[model samples]
Target: MQSSCRKTIAELGPPKHPVVSARSAGRTRDRSPSPMRGYLIPSPLPTRRTRTFSATVRASEGPIYKGVCKCFCRSKGHGFISPADGGPDIFVHISDIEGEYVPVAGDEVTYKVCTIPPKNEKLQAVEVVITHLAPGTKHETWSGHVISS
Candidate 1:
């Protein structure tokens, strides 16, 4: 039986492989044009380029921001301010308004962002003061009507 199996094997041919012939060897290599070639890719002339984060935020500083008084009422003595830089609206109380300015809607204002403590509440804008009337806004002049930040 072993002799018959060997005779049958001898009649069969060897298996095909990539390295068997020059024609097959050509098929194994990539022939497409590469995008990296023949183009003037800019290299850093001075410093070698490094992996870096491009969208880092500014360093933390005193949270003073320019905003406008959204609403204010002498009776309620509380309102919210819309920040000019598009942050969340901050709560402001009449007591926070220092100097002689009375904040009103559309009044250009400056305030400091403060975090609420203890029981936990929304962030508040403290040291609220009217910076100036918004463009085209008019108000009767009181002494120190506009408070500078």
Candidate 2:
């Protein structure tokens, strides 16, 4: 299992050339035009990758909550939580979410999100994968594990 810090660094490659700051009181004069650099260094920006996942919809239950226009907000630190009919929050990747059909708030939409878990680490909601459209009905009910008091 890779730590978050390690993963971040690995994703972001090492810097290319060392940057030198100009001295304050250095008298400099240039007559000839500066030569164009031969090779261009690659950017260090991290590559954007989309992952897919599935979860149910719930308000303030788990982490993610559906927002206006198919967009979802993360709960705590996890990614977006997709809503389903009476089920766990469906995790979906932000990339997998289609921008064409904007999902309205409270609309049951399907999407895909990323999921990463380390061995021995407790599983947590990371992203949401909108799969199927939940049936439209007022006052929906769900069943959960019964806990004996």
- lDDT by residue (17-73, candidate 1, tens digit) is 545675675455543433222221111211111212221111123556899887665
lDDT of 1: 0.54
Give candidate 2 misplaced runs (Cα > 4 Å): 1-79, 82-85, 111-115, 119-149
Lowest summed lDDT window (length 10), candidate 2:
38-47
TM-score of 1: 0.48
Model 1 misplacement above 4 A? 1-61, 119-121, 135-149
The prediction achieving the highest lDDT against the true structure is 1
Global lDDT scores for all candidate models: 0.54, 0.31
**TM per candidate:** 0.48, 0.26
Q: Please give the lDDT score for candidate 2.
A: 0.31
